[model samples]
Target: MRRIVNITILLYVLFGVSMYIYFFTGSDIGIPVEYKGTSADPTTFMNARELVLSEEYSSVKNFLFFLGTPFEWIVLFLFMVLGVSSKFEQWAKAITSKRFVQFFIYFFYFSISMFLLIFPFRFVSYQLSKAYHISVQSFSSWMKDMTIDFWVNFIMMFVAMHVLLLLMKKSKRRWWIYAWCMTVPLTLFLTFVQPVLLDPLYHEFRPLQNKQLEERILEMAEKADIPANHVYEVNMSEKTTALNAYVTGIGSNSRIVLWDTTLEKLGENEVLFIMAHEMAHYVKKHIYWGIGLGLGVSLVGFFVVYKLVSFIQRRFGKMMRVEGKGSFAVIPLLLLLFSLFSFVISPFTNYVSRYEERQADTYAIEMTKDNESAVKAFQTLAKTGLNEVDPPMLVKIFRHTHPAIVERILFLESYDGKIDR
Candidate 1:
């Protein structure tokens, strides 16, 4: 068992190192020849310094993206293999006789431990954003946000795990199915409350201050047949220079949000194009489709986890000090397995996300009939975010949710509107 753990760690480390060298050590990739002299060229929009920064930033971000899952898997696996999880379980049991109370205690310590273990990576990521001039937040403000995030995640996980434990006690083999069933309501609740309750915790949100712009957005919404009465603007200027807009939530909780930076940086037509893109997500029902797909994937994932847990128990139960399927000590192992599964399935999920994004883009242009603004919007988005127009194929497969910036721009440049209207 010790040998196997050592091998797993070594393999993951090797994989990360090899991929980094292969992906990042090459000369900065240039725009393809087909786009070299065209408006779609990244060089046309971004200056030389900006281009260099984008490449450097993209390399680091993509490396970290590939490194993240393996590092998490390693930490979770170590907690189980090195007896840390059992120690946490024992400490929790020592303080209380009530099962739920014990679990809360155990999970609190475990979650903190995992957070600290992973904190360095998070710190590096934050520092990277600052170094690239993408984040304007101070350390104190960032830490405050982090603390809120920690507590929010803690409460949510505590409730979920408590339910899992109850289900486990009822039927060890079928607990995953029961837990899966519970996710539908949980997803709905979070979606319904997140924009109102959770989002306001980090940043202030208000009605779009520009009445004319708001009216125009509402008119676009009306044309899309969306029921939204107001456009929301988030105060992101204090936090970052990045520009963004998105449609979030379900039912009446649903709304379109734009970062104030997006409003300040882009022309009115560009902003409307972006807004139309977001509304297209709602109009096309991508939100519902995403939720359904996630639930479907989770259903399969839970079943696989069930089978894997049984196998782990039969093979290395004593070595890991986790004797039963239902024991709290098994939490780390379960997490490790889930991390591995998520890593394996990410490419597929990303593909679906990219497809949805493409559909939204097409709808945005058709609804607005403003191809020039659409092109400008994509270019500005890439510039502000320090995004490479053409990332490496591997990075696109795993990291990109939308079509490549170059692709989006070129598509907008070539699109012709229907003349009959």
Candidate 2:
């Protein structure tokens, strides 16, 4: 019976992954490369406002792009229903009945199972990236980074689940509220330490090497009243060809970081525009506001979960071998619920993000007073990143965090601000 169950689980995983790739990833279909506007603004961007990719290229990218959190939720559900988590708990009990030791053992067994189950998706995604020349790193180097990422995520999951499960064991009804409360401080702590501690484990970082450019960026930061001590540069070129920049951490820990690739590939004007966008996030207090909004939504989510989880536990716990929220066996069920909640709330979350992203774009345009620079920077980013210039409304509402590239460029071109320096 046990062997049959194991085989069933294996088949389910194999079949599910294949179907997921086929339906959600995308098929081999031709994609048209057409720009909407006929008139080219030579002052704005060289290519007018358009995104062009080969039919094969689009398929490969879309193929690798697993649809959001559903895949994750499905994998978690399978892991639970197959009694994988329970089996791990049983194995750990043979080693030692100690709750502390069991949690650690359970963490590895469950985490490794989840990781391995998702490994094919990761492997295929990386393979496609390399095939497309977007990822430059060798296979061995990629695996090392993946290992580091796994451990970092392991620690985070352990901390969060440990607190929640402990609370669950103590009080049935109030644990969700307490867990939500705990996340406020925990989330901030992780955010504060991420740039300082965790990020270095995966990539090397240094202060910007070009003193002239660094000084100019600092000047803009001063104008924006952004209190960054040093503009940092990360060695992202070692891994991928993608361009990215962001502000991370908070208060004493806050810093604006640019990818080394940005320096290598972009002109100095474009770099300043990018810096202005990141600085706007800090100057506008988007980071803190984001945290506040997250906590507020979390409070609501936890309340909903509090009502629903017990009902689930009461109805299906014994049959599924997931006794309650406190049981390790319940992890998969909880993940299913969390994934559903996240997916339902995603549109609202993305709406907020898109709004903030537009604000940053506007701020960059106003601060730099160089619409040309902002537009060109985004063009470069879209070219490198293969961003959709004008996504449909559904994509924007459900997934995209930023305004479409064409929309941003058009907004910049039409804005009434001029910088006088």
Candidate 3:
């Protein structure tokens, strides 16, 4: 029995290390390319914008899109099989009898599962882009991106998981109340403070100084019913050519950030259209809705984790290993199991996001009355970003946030007679 458990642990570690090696080694190989554009080109600019707004790229990105699905199934299968297996159940009963063993086992599985599942996607992205001559062929650049993302995401995941676990242990029956209390304040802080405060740790942001463009943008904001005082341009070109703009912060900190590349590449009308879409997000209170949705999801996630953990503890308390005094090595395993459980729930979350995105699009079209500009902007974005012209329907349903560019254009075409609102 001990031998079997030890072998399972070894297999888990081996699989994790193999995946990590595949990612790092693949990313070390670079693709060489000479970019034709010295500054952000209009075509490139438009392509970038379109890529963000399109569901077309999901074909290639499907590896990641469907990655979690299999993992979730595997987890469910493992848990159920183990639960029913007389040998494993006897071992778990023995192990879970010790609190330290139970905790360590859950923690170990959680950490390893998360690391294995998520780490390879970064490598996949790096290799795919290099293959297509989209990304620079530099190990340092790849490492930089990987490291920055790892640290930021690691902190967020760690806090969320630990807090959830603590809450579950504390309240038992009323855990939801405690979880909600902890979640709401943290969500608000992350939304309002992190963008301005913590985000700069990973990327530099500087004020954009195109006086002419800034003035025009401010005027446009005023016309759109968004306060001119809330608009700012930031120099995001210092990073990569991946053009992006976002409306972040709440209340006084709330502002519109136009990436330098976006400002340089887009025409006045296109920029206005983009800004109008962002404004629509604010006007429709999408941020608050997002916060509420996150809380709801977390609540569901807590119940799932709690029930699963309790079941495991009740069934297999004795057979798990004790690594140290009062330490059970199963904590990671539990975390992994919980993550897998959460992955199963991801499709529902994605559905909610897609709905919100559609709502924002409707608001943008209605408010801007410039459906033509929106369509052109999306096309240019798709081209510049080298996004796939069309993605498979399954990919779009599972992974995409925005509607397909072609779909958006067609929708706009149907409204040709309308004036710019």
Candidate 4:
């Protein structure tokens, strides 16, 4: 068992370090010569200092991003291997007779332990963003936000894990199928409520103060056959310099939310083009499709997890102090397995995301018929966020949800704007 743990740790470290060196070591490779003088050019959009800062930021961000999963896996594995998870479980059981109370108590300990163990990586990442002026939030504000994040995540995880364990206890052999069934509606419920209930906790949202832009956005929504009555603006400038806009929620709860930074940075038509892109997601039902794809993956994922977990329990249950298939101490092992599975499947999920984003971009161009504004919108996003307009292929595979900025801009530049009627 020690040999297995040691070997796993070594493999994780080697893979994480090697990938960081391979993809994020040097300066961004940059776009082709044809884009050099164009608005899409990174060199022209940002000064040399900003360019260097972007590279440094990307390297650190990618390092943290890539290492995060492995670190969590190791932590969870160690908790199980070192008997810490069993200790936590024992401690919780000693405190309560009620199973639900015991579960919550154990979960709180597990969640906080993991949070503290993983916090330094997050702190370093946040500090670097602040140092590079990417994040303008003060340390106090950041801490507050972190606290909010912790509680929100804790509550959500508590609910999900409680249900999962309940299902496991009821049907040890069929728990994964039962859990997957529960997960589908839970996911949809979160998506439906997030824009209204959760989002307002982090940022102040209001009707777009610029009534004219709001009117125009509503008009666009009307033209797109969307039921939106208002366009919302979030004060993201308070936290970061990043520009963003998106569609969120479903049915009556649906909203078009623009970051204040986007409104401040771009022109009316550029904003309109961005809005059109967001609206495309609604018109095309990308959110529902994304949910379907995710649930479909989760169905398969849960089954794989069930098989792997059962194999682990049969092989090493005594070593980990996991009593049986129904033991709550097994949660750490379940988490470790799920984390590994998510990392393995991320490339496929991101590929689908990129495809959807490209579709939205095309839809935006067709609806607005203003290729210049579309190009400038992407260019502005790249400059404001210090985004890599043309990242390496590996980064695109794992990290990128949208097409590279340069690709979007070049597409817009070359578009003939003949709408398909």
Candidate 5:
């Protein structure tokens, strides 16, 4: 009864605190409490020069990301405002007849235009990685991979825009509704197809070769109620020194993948803990949860676009020559709004992802019963990945999909799973 009473009091406190934080953050001039920004300051810590360097590096990277992401959207919007979309529209008229083909033409250039705008920043990030000795791939190899990525993006964008335009043409009132409905199955299908069809375009994969480790992995998978069919290794060492592992795809395409760097660098027990974490992701059915959540978010985003886009187009449409919903050029306006909405909504998305990651971390610690190994694996990961042990709170709220490495290790150290030995 005492324990129950204490728990009730604790719950009330937590609820009150959460409400306070939400209210504090929900307004136009709401506190940017997360941006206090001193957590990553090197002067704050003792003993570890590595942590200082890592945090400094992360700060630069984060700044680059902040500058680059919004810059693209701003540039695209500026082009439309400056009447570049009209010029592109004339080119599309000269080139193609089928509405689908015309959209493909517009988006091919549209996608590449964004890519070109962002490429210099990406290259700078690449140079930073090389300076840090994290990335190992040569410029030629990187360009090759990026070229493939470009084509893939172009195709995906074309199909998505074509379909969206079709939906709008048929029912402007209900297009967002139809588009929101389509997101669920499409996301699932891509998740199913990615491991089998798409992953090979970037990396080499093979069945994990160490028979002893493979046996242990299979045993762990069985214990975790996973399929235990395959453990695949990706040659990530060819690109970067980062140690990583993940369970990706679903159903037939579901597989556990380990980076070759992870295999080379981590011990067998550490590998098992990591694999257990990946298995936890599958067992939790986080993919379907993500799909459902994304569908809902997409629905909300589409509704917002539906409500506000026409007003925007009407006010600026004649100047840009992008009149009406059926105009192929409407795609750019849609993307602009979607990008802004995504930026605005990022904190909520990151919150859910971080929750799922923490759940998987707890499940991993319990399933492995090797708290030391799990902690050690995360330590190795943090070191290899150059993760900031204590990132800025704004980074956590806005961009981080997982909890900080320090918090993860601390949680493992304090966890009391107490499963029978």
Candidate 6:
């Protein structure tokens, strides 16, 4: 029975590694190119922009994205089957009989596994950035950044996991109630505090120092009916050359973060357009909508896991390998299964996100009254991010968070007249 468990673990690890290698190596992934002159074919240029901005490559990336769902399902199915077996039940009974021992074993294993997986990826990703000449920081600097990030996230995860365990013990319907209660608060905290508290751990943040630009942004915010205090800038140039920006938080705490790299690369008009787009998200209340959608999806995922686990236990209770009864070692296995189920729903989530992004883009056009800057900003962003010029369609559906750049440009071009503020 122990050997069988070991075999299962080995197989799972191998499968994961295989998938990673296949996706990382098989895709013709490369950094975005600098945009050249009018001599470039318009259709080709647009396609290239779309590919870069969308981060799509050949069909390989899309295939891997799609493949994630089934792979997760397989893992979940195996866990469900193994968890309910007589042998696993016995093991669970023993572990639950000593709660401290059970907790320590699972917690330690989880922590170690997460660290091993995440830390190396951080190092490798940094190396890749350096190789591409996109990195702005040295290895030592990157390591310092990683250390700060690790501690912040590690502490948060520790607190959250313990809280979840507490909730799991108290709830009558463990998965559903836990999911519902945790989702709202977790989403809110991550959206709000993450930018203000967590982000500063990795990069320095300062107020927008360009008084003229700042004033213009505030004016735009007032015109757009978004609060002025939410606009700020972060010194992201110390970390990487990749241009980026985001809107986060909610209500009074909500704010816009403009990467210094973006501010440096884009003209004032382009920056204003980007700021307008972010403000649109806040004014339109997309943050709250997104959180609500996330909660709903999480609830559905929890229910699916609960039902599936129950079914497995009922169907094959005697065959399970574990010794004892009513063990909760099965919980992690259930989580693994749920993760797989959630991956299946990722496309829907991406679609919803893309829709919200499009709305924000429209708002930017209206506010800026200049589709040209918006187009230029996207092109510049693509170049900064080393985006592929044209990714396959399947890649777009599975992986893209925003509409392809070409699609966005075409949409803007379709406007019949000057956009009204």
Please report the candidate that would top lDDT against the real structure. 1
Model 6 residue 160 CA deviation (Å) reads 3.8
Compared with the true structure, what per-residue lDDT tens digits does model 3 show for residues 77-188?
3443343223332454466776545443454454445556655766787676665545554768667766677667666765665566566566666664676678778888
TM-score (all chains, Cα) for each model? 0.96, 0.87, 0.70, 0.95, 0.86, 0.76
lDDT score for residue 162 of model 2: 75
Please say which candidate is ahead in lDDT: 1 or 5.
Answer: 1
Tens-digit lDDT string for candidate 1 (1-421)? 7897889888998998887896688635567898897777878988999988998898898888778767888888788878899999999999999988899999999999988988888889999999999999999999999899999999998888778768877997788999999999999899888899999999999999999999999999998899988999999998899999898889989989999999999999999989988998998899999999999999989899889988888888888777775689888887888777776787899999988887888888898889989998888988999988888888777777788888889888888864221
Per-model RMSD to reference: 2.1, 4.6, 9.2, 2.0, 11.3, 5.8
How many clashing residue pairs, candidate 6? 27
Worst 10 residues of 4 by lDDT: 21-30
What are the Cα lDDT values of the candidates? 0.87, 0.76, 0.59, 0.87, 0.78, 0.66
Q: Sort every candidate by TM-score, greatest first.
A: 1, 4, 2, 5, 6, 3
Ranking by lDDT: 1, 4, 5, 2, 6, 3
* Poorly placed runs, candidate 1 (over 4 Å): 26-28, 417-421
Instruction: Show where candidate 4 strays beyond 4 Å.
Output: 1-5, 24-28, 33-35, 418-421
Q: Which residue pairs in model 4 clash with each other? A: none
lDDT of 2 by residue, 310-330 (tens): 887788666667874467777
Local accuracy of candidate 5 as per-residue lDDT tens digits, 254-341: 8899999999989999998898888889999998898788888988999999877767767867765567668776777888889999
Evaluated against the true structure, the overall lDDT of model 1 is 0.87
> Distance from true position, residue 147, model 1, in Å?
0.6
Q: What TM-score quantifies how close candidate 3 is to the native fold?
A: 0.70
Candidate 6 stretches greater than 4 Å from native: 1-105, 118-122, 163-175, 313-328, 417-421
